[model samples]
Target: MSAPKPIRSIVIVGGGTAGWMAAAALSRLVRTGVSVTLVESDAIATIGVGEATIPPIRNFNGLLGIDENDFLSKTQGTIKLGIDFIDWTREGHRYTHPFGEFGFDIEGVKFHHYWRKLYAEGKASWIEDYNLCATAQKLGRYTTPVADPASVLSRLTYAYQFDASLYAAYLRAYAEARGVVRTEGKVVDVLLRSEDGHVDAIALEGDRRITGELFIDCTGFRGLLIKGALKTGFESWKHWLQCDRAWAVPSANPGREITPYTRSTARRAGWQWRIPLQHRVGNGYVYCSDDISDDEAAATLMANLDGEPLRDPMLIRFEAGRRKLAWNRNVVALGLASGFVEPLESTSIHMIQTGVSKLMALLPDRDFSPVERDEYNRQTQIQMEQVRDFVILHYHANERTDGDLWRRVREMDIPETLQRKIDLFRNRGRFFRYDDELFADSSWIAVLLGQNVMPAGWDSLADAVDPALVRQRLDRIREVFRRAAEAMPRHEDWLARNCPAPTASVTRKTA
Candidate 1:
């Protein structure tokens, strides 16, 4: 019946996007007499290929009070309207999963429902036509969205393509400036308490002992604290997500106009990602090792570069899964330390951001109640599963005949949750969002339709609207999006005029 004591000292192990982000976000606690210390070794390198992101990142930046323009300039950032998936459904086919919503809803019926009816009647264009982000991406345009509800430009949403290392450095400076202590050393050992089996302190290589009330693990895939010390178990999803290896390399810019989107081109054995930053382009080939050799994967990546290779390809090995308990005992895991779904959708950093957000929301006291721990675990598992299913959809719904990888994934048994969504959409375009999943209805609609998964019938409610009126409205919306995109500045021009990196040279090219 005693009052719970508040946590005082907080220690973050490892430093990269995850550790620095946790430090920066928790820096506010310094004013409340809670010490935040981050320990990292300068010798360790991070997997910095997480250059693309979704729109929620803007909210994360806003939470940190980061100036958009300044952050872009410092991080060599470029706008990412969404991902352009090439040859995913089938060879020679393409589609975009844009960040913003599709056409406006009509009379309480979803816009896609009306579009489906119109499409079936040969009166509608591609779903991307009604999306301002997709239109702007196609036109190579860039601009911040407006607040006007009536304007087509107001519907635009975007994320960033930037150097992950530069972003971590930027956040490190921010955290350090806000009084978060940074210790330079590698952790040699983790000491645990006797009675409760909780992490008591970390022993550094140089005979340093750092003690804290709460510990955060950001040690990449090593899971140094959460799994290494606490013995937390991992639940692997490798069978469902089989691409466990990647060959990453950077390439020189081709001097063409920078695009406002990320490009994911499906390969014979896997897929390749192209993320353009202001200074250079980030490229990677993620594939299953069983289907392709490391050398072959690297060769494929090098052969497809738009420009000269900047460095030798780096091979990365990983499994697609999450720790069974993200919050085990008093230790919380973030980023790769917690789990890793492939960066196909660029959810790595977003996962770290959400972990930090959830930690803040359910911050615990010295008692470390199981109630709080259980809730955090539940939320984390659900969110990870949702993302896993979304990523799986891209592979499962493919129509490619290039390699066994595609065929196997397509024929594989996906999670029942994903199956339910696909089944519902296939029936009558009846898709539903569960547990407030990360990808919204618009996202699902885009991938479902883009990959040629047509619904058998339109929503019953869509039948109430007049077909002619729906077609007219759809035509008007498409034209408005096109004209609005045309009015925006070129992506390169916008970067030059607003937040170009010091080393970036702007080049104008006809779209």
Candidate 2:
């Protein structure tokens, strides 16, 4: 056997949030001598669908050395404390899935269990009151968490809602400033190596051919390099997630206070997202095509906008699944090329960030060892399935009988993993995190309770605490959180003072 060859050239196909994210990560993380090249054409458009993100995004940006304030200003970003799920359990029903932990653990017991005891007696305040992020978000407040362990502000975790397109531009500039090379062209054909059946080079429209030791496909749902060229297969998860298409549009803010959280309102056949940014609101209706027509979906989105429409609704087609092998041979797929779990929890960009981080962790030589690829695929599969389950929980645990779409999801069988989770939660509110899955126990509890999936029994250990003490602590905690939120600066006021974007560069468009 010959000696292993180190990867010298890295080629990334497509350019968008995913492509640029990979570029930025590789350019910064990859050591010297390994060149990173991104090939894309100006004619291609990315889905740019996910505007809101989860809390983990802070780590991703921190890795990129991005200043939070600058990123917010440049990307027209606003704080996202959590997601307000409206009409999901039923019409007019609402709940907030926040980023931070709930009431602090008292004497080594979960707070929710004690709350459950009170909740059953109709004495506990809404579960949202125990969470700093949710409480503050409800009060239109915004503040970054502090490092001090004693301060309530320490628990105020959050994410961001930003312009996806602008984020890509910002990352492009960052990646270029590093060492990633940007190639402007469209891939017309692919050349393969005979021995290994790996992509050898890609022919551009203008007779330019670029070759590399490895390829990263960020070609969105088309999977231009992974599936189109390498013939990698895909796994459809439509049965679990029926929302295969989305219609997106931006709207003016209409002079209302910018809320520091995303709102997902359940529509007749699907759900619509309202994400507030510094300049405009990003709204999208993600519906199952089989249940709703494109025209009706578009109309529903238009009629529900909080402000005047700024652009024609852009339709995006997708399948809720992933590639059978994210790293097939020498090709690795990212973004929609890998798979989509929708934006219900604002995970689109976070998935991309994770993909990049995993790839870097398993960086391989030119030989592209199967061990590395297999590990990458295994990790990716686990993370995707975990996220899929979380998103599925939102759809599968619905109480709404008003729509066929909800009925189908409600009655349909889910993965055994998710089933077991629901069962455990239903038993005594016991839910465990496996392999460091992205969603925490608090998140599960939030959704479970929000959708009215109550526990038949609270943890018996919760009974150890004196009933009077539990009540006293719960009331004190709730009141403290409420008063703290009431005192913080408003979301809009916070942005104006710190990270406000330059006055809308383009005139606000109206329908």
Candidate 3:
């Protein structure tokens, strides 16, 4: 048996979040005989409108040894406790998909079941009354969770809203300082090996050619190598998710308190997002072109801004699906090149981060074993599919009767995965997390109940105790959470005292 060849040079085609993220991960984790190189054109721009994110991003940064304060200061970032969903069920209805557990499980039963039992008896308050994240958000408060499990502060979980462009630059410095070479030019042609049709090298201007044993594709939407060269097809998800166009714009800070959450307001044909950053607020209207024109979308976005526009809305068109195989042959696709769900749940950047994480885990030798590639593709498919289900939930479980889009989605057929979850929750208030799904039970509960999908029955155990005792227990828990939330510092005050961005940055050189 011959020894497998070692991979030496890795070429990342394109830049922005995905390419730089790949560079950053390889620069930190790659073992013997491997080096990372990234090629991006100075003329090309990034789809940096992906500003909101989930909590795992903090872990991603921590793994790279990124100090929290430094990251926030550099990226114009802000804390996010959850997403504020408005008018999702119907007009004038609002709910928060918070990041933490609700009222800590009581005894052996989930808290929601107990709460549900009370609510059925007209003894419970709104769902938010049990969540610290929701309470803190309502009061404009923010605090990092403490380490002690017994403490009220320990339940808090968080994410962030940031300027994606600055984040890419921040990571660029991190990767470059670790010896990842950067080439500045666009690929004029992709050369494939005659024997296997594998990408061998890419041609740039000035007649220069750069070759590598492995290639990473981060060229947003273009799929320059994976789909364009390898002919790996895409699995279109437009049927389930029909909203395909977005108009993104930045707005001046409204000189008001920055809420510690992202807000998504349902529109006639789609939804508009509000992401508050330290320096500005990012706003966008994502709508289906079948129902609204580009000009109408842009005008809708502009009209909805809370402050003056920073720049004209940038209209971006996208399809909702992923590549058939994120890793094909010698090339692996990352970020938008691999696939995209609309920025509805703010999964864009997280998708890029997860792809890079999976790539590092499946680092292959020069032989590029098909087994590893298939596993990587399989996991990627599951992750994308899981997220697709969650995103579709927001659209499918709606009660809005004002628009045809809503009506269509409400009646649309969803994946069996989501259907099963929804069915379980509806049948008996049982929400279970399967296959390490991204959205936890609390998240599902928040959405299901907020959308008015009440369970027919809760866990039978809720009846084990006297109903009056259950109400008293829930009341005590809710009161403690409310007091704890009220005591936390305001998000703005916390930012100013802890990690405010400097008014000016020259080169962003770390001391």
Candidate number achieving the greatest lDDT relative to the actual structure: 1
lDDT of candidates 1 onward, in order: 0.93, 0.90, 0.88
* Candidate 2 lDDT by residue in tens digits, 390-475: 99999988888687899999999999999999999899998788888998888998999998899999888898889988899999
Model 2 poorest 10 in a row by lDDT: 502-511
Error of 3 at 58 (Å): 1.0
lDDT of 1 by residue, 51-110 (tens): 999999999999999999999999999999999999999999999999989989889888
Clashing pairs in 3: none
Clashing pairs in 2: none
For candidate 3, the lDDT comes to: 0.88
Query: Candidate 3 lDDT, tens digit per residue, 1-511?
Result: 9887778899999999888878888886444557888999989988889889999998899989999988988888889999999998898999888888888676799999988888887899988889988889888789778989889898888999988888889999999998899999989899999999999999999899999999999999999899888999999999999999999999988878877899999999899999988888999999999998898888888999999998888889999999999999999999999999888788888888888888888888888889889999999999999999988999999989898999999998999999998899999999767667777888889888888888989999878888877788888989999999988888877777677878622111111
Clashing pairs in 1: none
Selected candidate, larger TM-score, 1 vs 2: 1
Q: What TM-score against the true fold does each predicted structure earn? A: 0.99, 0.97, 0.97
At residue 271, give the lDDT of candidate 3. 97
Sort the candidates on lDDT, descending order.
Answer: 1, 2, 3
| Model 1 local distance difference test score | 0.93
